[model samples]
Target: MADDNPGFSDPVTLFQDVEDLKAQIARLTGLIDRLTAGGGDDPAGPGDGDTGAPAQDADAEGEEEDGYPPFILLLDSPAYDEELRALIEWVEGVLVPGYLAEPSSDAHWCHLWFEHPVAVGRLHALWLAWQELTEPATCGYTGPSTWHRDHLDPCMRELRGRGGPFGGCTKNEHQIAHRQPSLVPSAWRMAES
Candidate 1:
């Protein structure tokens, strides 16, 4: 039967080839997970603690001084006008107020300790939704989801180097739209109708 088709290969060789491919895929997947999950380091690591000394010194120095580290917000894309507006509203109304005040206020610092994975996961979900809404080829282009998964570090670094938040970090759009899911009803509903 193998000889009947000119393109046919040996069954044992095919099986071996498939096994090798599977092994390689597994290895690659493990690597991706490690790389994405803060490379084995704790997401909310030691840096988040208030050393107390420096802050106290700064407080003693001057209350009006620019002591607080600036905030960073990473948006997935500018194309999803409705969702983008909704996200901006969410940042201003909900997320910023909830996370940037009181006990969790330290999380506002880009350099401070944080649940990096959780933040990254949330950004990733937003990125996915953004891709679905903007990219015509995406499965949910006309569906509900409207966010994308944007990496914060690069965007933050760019913002820092620019000396302000208006540097236009749109260059990282590709990275922002990766590793996202196809559907996100909550995000879709959150967008302006």
Candidate 2:
């Protein structure tokens, strides 16, 4: 008799469970639709896009789940390995390419970094930091903000400083003062692997 809140217990709980299950079903249905129907016009489907992460709402802004362009992988996410591999590929494939090509400040005009030991180590750490600072709900700033302020600026200053890695390839009169300070091309090539 004391448990007389009977209606609040079983039936209500069952109803709540049913609602949750329904919501999950609806979400899963949407995923299947996207995967089967394609990301856009092409019939190749969302998997064809394969940009690693799932698609985001074109209208949504500042409320992204993984922050932005540089997504940090959460172990619970199904796309964990995919996203991480993508990030690694971008850093190696695109981000650090300039450094390998020309390890001078003149290479990219004031922010380029050469593939020196110190530079490579710093950029690797910077990349990792980017992943951490851009977590969906953890960091204080947005992705670009965190990258420029926290990871990019400081690391760039250090890695391209007059005494920093890449021998501080600062743009003086727009000339590469030194022709690649350290870390021979062969070494950087090996590191790329």
Candidate 3:
């Protein structure tokens, strides 16, 4: 018998695809929940814990939900999934460009940025903060600067400092340590010379 579908024709590949789609759907559902239900303070990011004040809608909306941002859906948090890949790309293309200018740091970003669980968690939280802080004040936000101060700063310190994610890695630009050992085992890193 000929296989009508070469890829999914095999039960194993079909099962894997089904599982991936289900995971994607679950992640999206959680994202929707975060958007509507307001985010709670994720343990990873700064400004965690209650203020003993009313929760602003913008503040609530920025919290990372259980499934969250979906960059963390896998056991190893690989960026092979399209949505997860897009998130990492945004951090690489947009966030890094907007904030840091050190070529060595950018090299560090290329090398160690994605291979740390804490980095991934903090970045996702920071992105949520960005979303909340960028909304207008009428949306109950003070503005995007809060994200810079509260979320972005500390994460930057951890991800970019000498003792940060790139610790023990080469400090050369136009060159990277190239996927040196990740601080956290869960994040998937790619080596590009």
Candidate 4:
């Protein structure tokens, strides 16, 4: 049998790839759990008392205040639309051709994925991480692997999975007939008791 995808040569290679993916998922899950609980070993997490605030570096706040657009959801920022356009370009030129697998019901996609807020958010995040990690000067040799394991694979899984934003979409199809899901009202909007 001829293997179409040159990336995976044989059945054993494919099996190994699956095993590697499983290991990566396990590691990522463990890392998330550890970070969420504010360090794995601690019963009483970071910040004063049991506040469980994420432990941030002293420079973390400064970085944001310096007008660094670390996220694409900055609608108020002047760069929002430009950043979004760049994201779309990268998705089309790099991600779709390079990373996206053949779409099936289990792993669906839509050409007009930007219409979905969830897809936009996730893809933006993935693109941002890709920029940071793939820079050889900044992240070094292990960066690409870390990005794939910690970011790309997970983001793609969530975006393309059965329960993902593209769940209702089909391969190469862009159906906006169904509106995006609505969120519950914010607590601030509710009247005080």
**Which residue runs of candidate 3 sit more than 4 Å off their true CA positions?**
1-80, 103-108, 137-141, 171-193
For candidate 3, list the clashing residue pairs, or say none: 38-60, 39-60, 39-63
lDDT (Cα, tens digit) per residue for candidate 4, span 1-193: 3657777668776875675565456545544554577643543233221111123432443225322335666564455666678789889988999998788988888888988877888998888677656654344455677789889999999988888878878765676645565888778778653
lDDT of 2 by residue, 122-180 (tens): 65567656554444333333444545666777776675556554453444533334555
State the displacement of the C-alpha of residue 97, model 2, in Å, after optimal TM-score superposition.
7.9
**Per-prediction RMSD in angstroms?**
20.7, 16.5, 18.7, 13.4
Q: TM-score winner between 3 and 4, please give it.
A: 4
Model 2's lDDT to the true fold? 0.49
Error of 2 at 117 (Å): 2.0
Ranking by TM-score: 4, 3, 2, 1
Model 4 error, position 149 (Å): 0.0
> How would the candidate models be sorted by lDDT, starting from the highest?
4, 3, 2, 1
Model 2: runs farther than 4 Å from truth?
A: 1-88, 92-115, 140-143, 168-193
- Candidate 2 clash pair list: 38-45
Q: How well does each candidate superpose onto the true structure, as a TM-score?
A: 0.20, 0.33, 0.45, 0.57
Task: Please tell me which model should have the higher lDDT, number 1 or number 3.
Answer: 3
lDDT, model 4, position 168: 79
- Candidate lDDT values, in order: 0.35, 0.49, 0.52, 0.67
Clashes of each: 12, 1, 3, 0
Instruction: State residue 9's C-alpha deviation in candidate 4, in Å.
Output: 32
